[model samples]
Target: MSEFNTTAFQPSLFILTGLRRLAGSRLWLGLLLSLMYIITMVGNCTVIHLVRKERSLQEPQYLFLSMLAWADIVLSVSTLLSVLKVYILGLYEIAFDSCLTQMFFIHTSSSVGSGILLAMAFNHFVAISKPLQYTTILTSSRVTRMGLAALLRAVALMTPLPILLKRLPFCKGRTLSYSYCLHPNVMKLACGQVRINILYGLVLVLFSFGVDSLLIAISYVLIFQAVLGIASREGQMKALNTCLSHIFTVFIYYGPLLAITVMHRISIRSSPVAHAVLGNVYLFMPPMLNPIVYSLKTKQIRTALRKSCKIQRS
Candidate 1:
């Protein structure tokens, strides 16, 4: 608690404060998380496999979907061991260096997901606005480049966060509020100069989520404009129908995130249980639901899946 402790010291371990109120129910909670993890992995992997194998799914949007699926897989994997350690193994101690690496992947993958959503919005806009030029505009190489750009941008922004915390001396007790290490939560344990950490974290959020969400909104506006200009009612419905799954994915991914971010800012008066529940939702819901949404809404994906199943039987 000493602000004057200028002696830079790195704690050997950090404790995770994971659903402490539910200590008696770790077995049930662990089982639930395990099921969610399995579902998320299978769902996303199926999406990726279908997109890669199906000739009918070689379009720009499906390619972006596979990218998002990959990101979701990474995000879920990064937290799997740590989460299971807390819930299943009754272990809360994480090595400091391991904590930093975990946070790095978690933040990077989440940001990449946001970036992919932005790319998807752009894909929809182009397809709806200029159907004739859609394939020419979003060529395969171009889609690959967009996915790579998202990953690179996330790495550049997040690489400094752990390094910044590494330089500071963590005089405060090394207990993180969530099951996983987040930059904001980890930085709070440092007693040394952290104004830069706070400022940079804020900047990172604004630049990544804020800017991406705004651009996505703008893209949708343009898409709706294009939809409105369609000559027939059936045409408008068909065009808008294409976006239903992505729109639902966006809501599942960002809604809990935005809510959790707001709660963190005012968490002094918030209940820990609320944080625990919402945090899990923000992490687990999107990955688990994305494939299901697409399978149910997209005719091509459903048809391809059925064909694949029938082929497997034969």
Candidate 2:
């Protein structure tokens, strides 16, 4: 089959196929997705609010935490709107330009979120691995600059992606199989040679996602080594506890991401519903879980939440 004619070329087919297995039930999928989105919004907002309201939490670390929460909020809103359009409105067809726009923002948000996580990892490393330098290294001004730089890097790196996609001639099926415009899904529709596009997409995966993940792993390794060097048992325990929130958040973000990447690579004839569901999970699940994980795992956040609730009650 031509690249455009592959089974994966059909956008909604994967989604419909998966939904059919649920006894042809769109209502159930819609309901479940809606509930998930609501939870995601509430959880992310709570985190942002707690960080802002608590005076003690006003450190450089929590500031980054707030930015991460805001990114999740944006991602959740975008995903929810698109999913609702697909499930409720039955709108499956997307224009070429619209697809490019959606793909750009989705990719941008995903990349930016990953970058922010890396920043968080670095912050923890400084705090745990280099205690004396922590104040100088993570000053408010420096954190602000770093946060802006990460966002700018995401925009610069991903901006070319959509433009390159738009230049391709999509001679095959214009109808996207998935609800949103993902790079692979859209690339499948290109009538022209897509070798370059494929290579570029792979490069993006490697550099943006793969490289960042490796760096995070290395940072944690160093952190662990430093923690081990501490003479006091209580000090080691405290350092480990400090790293817990970032570790949990990284797992939540990277786990579904790796799953979706694998599915996209190996599942040649996967159903549209399967792709859609997985894509949604990869994009939104981390954001959804982040607030809950940090709130429950971090002592500071838990205390802030309790205090926020008490103040609200008054």
Candidate 3:
């Protein structure tokens, strides 16, 4: 271990890289990112507001939607400043501790988002399969408990990441592949034995995203079985329509995620721009699109939005 101690060095700061190829077009890129950030914040905040203010939206699904909006807001804020700093202000260096903090929040919020999606699937399942027990099973207190549980679980799972990263010696260049810090990207910079880190990350993925996806799929299958048992075609159509917004949001959230995962593990030699763009999309798109999807697909939200707008105008 004497040899290890001699070479061990902790970086003071990490460099964040945006689209290197489009360095000259930073103004446009920054503007776009800024716009996306604004939309994400506004959209999610509106969802939260609508859920809280509108008495009609106090149901389990809308409450769960509000929880998801909160997650999206957290996720977007975690990345917003760092990304803007790099692209807009040309300030790419981030302090080591700050990077770790960002990574923690980002991962925690992401896990929470995934968990919320799972909870939503369960919500849909209960609403469809056991309509009578839905209110009894998912009372206000229980929904609140579920939300807190998701937050706590995410924190518990992601807490180890920053600690593990802090212990390792980072001798590689301080340049991060993306504007924000991620466990795998940070781990790649460590010169010390990181087998434990890699294994832990894989464990996180398997237990969180992997397990959540499986459960969500099972929930949908059960939902389908319930739908099929409905005697009338109109009832079946109405039931399926309730899931359209959620299904779209799920696909939007997971598509870039799957691509990013593939690029991280398999196509390691792809362009840095590809990695950066996909990272941005994974972080940005779901948050921006979720509220829109729900608002468009769910008539209630649209009506509430219009009512809110007219009230403001008056």
Q: How close is candidate 3 to the true structure, as a TM-score?
A: 0.97
In angstroms, how far off is 130's CA in candidate 2? Answer: 1.4
Residue 286 of model 2: what lDDT?
87
Give the candidates in order of lDDT, highest first.
1, 3, 2
* Residue pairs with clashing backbones, model 3: none
Error of 1 at 297 (Å): 0.9
Which one wins on TM-score? 3
List model 2 lDDT by residue over 98-196, tens digit each.
Answer: 667777878888888898899899998899878899998899899888789778887888898877766566556565555566777777767566788
- Kindly indicate the candidate among 1 and 3 with the higher TM-score: 3
**Candidate 1 to truth, TM:** 0.96
TM-score, every prediction:
0.96, 0.89, 0.97
Runs with alpha carbons beyond 4 Å of true place in candidate 1: 1-8
- Which residue runs does candidate 3 get wrong by more than 4 Å? 6-8
- Residue 291 accuracy (lDDT) in model 1: 86
Query: What digit string (tens of lDDT, one per residue) describes model 1 on residues 44-140?
Result: 9999999999999998899999999999999999999999999999899999989999999999999999999999999999999999998899999
